[model samples]
Target: MSARVSDATSRLKSRRDDRRRHRIVGGLVAALIVVVLAAGVYVVAFSPVLSTRQIQVSGLKVLAKNDVVATSGIVLGTPLARVDITAAADRLAAVPAVADVTVVRSWPNAVSIAIVERRARLAIATDNGYLLADATGVVFQTVSDRPGGLVLVDAPTNDQQLLVDVGTVYSALSPDTAARVDRVVASTRDAIELRLKDGDRVIWGSAEQSGLKSQVLDNLLAKSGTVFDVSAPGFPTYR
Candidate 1:
C-alpha cells in the first residue's frame, strides 16, 4: 500500500513540474516577442537608418530645383516615416505654374518629387505685364514680353467667365484653323471674335456648340469673304 501511495505521489509531482516548465517557456517566448517588437519600432521610427539623406526632383523645366526644395519644407535628416508629405505637396501645389505634383518617400533615405507644369494656352495683357494663361483660363505667369506660339486674347481680367468662354472657342478650333488666328478679342461671352493672320475676322457668338461652329467654319473658310460669321453653324453666313 505504501509503495502504491509513493508511486501516485511521484506521478503528481512530475505532472506539476511539467506544467511549471511550460509556463516558464511561455513567459520567455512572450518576453522575446515584446523585445523584438520594441526593437523594430525603434529602428523604424527613431533610428537614423531610414532618415532622409537625399531629395530627388523630376519633371522640371522652367522651375528651379532649389526653389522647389525650399517650397517643400522637408528638412534633411528627418525620419522617412515622419515626413510631412501632405504639407509638402500642398505647398508645392500652390505655385501658380505647377498644375499637379506628387510627393513620396523613396525608401532608404530619399524623398522624390514629381511636378507637372501648366502649359500656356493664351497670353493676356495685365497691368503688370503679359499673363500666360492655361486652357482652363487660369493665369499662371507674368512675363515682361509676349510669349510666342500662343494666341493672344483681349478680355477683362476681372471677367473670369469671358476668359473661359474665349478659351473654349479657341480650344474647339482645329490645329489648322488655330494656326490661322493671330489674336482673339471678346467683350462678353456672346461677343467673342477671332482675328486671322490674313486680316480676316470671324464672328463667334458664344461658347455654345463650339465644336459644330468649328466644323462649319472649317468648311466655310474655303469660300471667299473678309468676315466669316458662324455663330449659327446650321445657317452660316459670310459677307
Candidate 2:
C-alpha cells in the first residue's frame, strides 16, 4: 500500500509539472505574437514602402508643369501619409493664374495635383503693358499687346471692384452683343459705359439689372442711334 501511494503521488507531481510547462509555452507564444504585430505596425508606418514615387499635374495652360511642381514643394520619396494636401494646394494657389487647386495623394505611392486656371475676361491698359483680367477682376497675366476678342476696360482707378462690375455687365450681354463690345469705361461705380465696335455708345449705369439692360440694348441697337441709354432698362432712351 505504501508503494502504491508513493507511485500515485509521483504521477500527480508529474502532471503538475506538465501543466506549468504548457502555461510557460503558451505565454511565450503570446509574447512572440505581440512582438510580431508591433514590428508590422512600425514597418507600415515608417518604412519607405509607402513613400511617394511620382507627382502628376493636370489642367495646365499658362503655368509650366515644372514651375508648378517646384512651387508645390512636394518631394519624391516622402511618406504618403505625411504629405499635407491642404498646404500643398495653398502653395499652388499663390500662383497668379491659378484660380483653384486641388492636391491629393494617389494610392500606391503617387501624388496628383489638379489646377484650374483663371480665364481672361477683359484687358486693362497699363503703362508697361496690358493686364489680363479674369471674371473675378483679378489681373493675372500681362502682355505687350491686347488679345483679340476681349473688350478693353478703362477705369478711373485701379479699382478691382469696378472691374468686377464691368465683367459682370459684359457677361450679362448676349453673345452677339458681347462680341460687338469694343471698350468698357467706368469713371465711377455708377457711371459705366460700353462702346460698341460699330461706333455706338451704350450708357449702361451700374452693374445692377445688367441682364435686362443688355436685352434692352439689343433691341435698341436695331434702331438708328448713336447713343443708347439703358441705365434704367424699364425706361430705355436712344438718340
Best by TM-score: 1
Q: 1-239, model 1: which lDDT tens digit per residue?
A: 99999999999999999999999999999999999999988877789999899999999987899999999999998889889999999999999889999999999899999999989989988777788888767777889888888888899988988888888898899999999999999988898899999999999899899999999999999999999999988999998
TM-scores of the candidates are 0.88, 0.80
Model 1, residue 182: C-alpha shift (Å):
1.1
RMSD, one per candidate, in order: 2.2, 4.2
Compared with the true structure, all predictions reach lDDT values of: 0.91, 0.89
- List clash counts for every candidate, in order: 0, 0
Report the lDDT tens digits of candidate 2 across residue range 38-134.
9876655567888888999999989899999899999888888787888999999998899999999997699999999999988898887798988
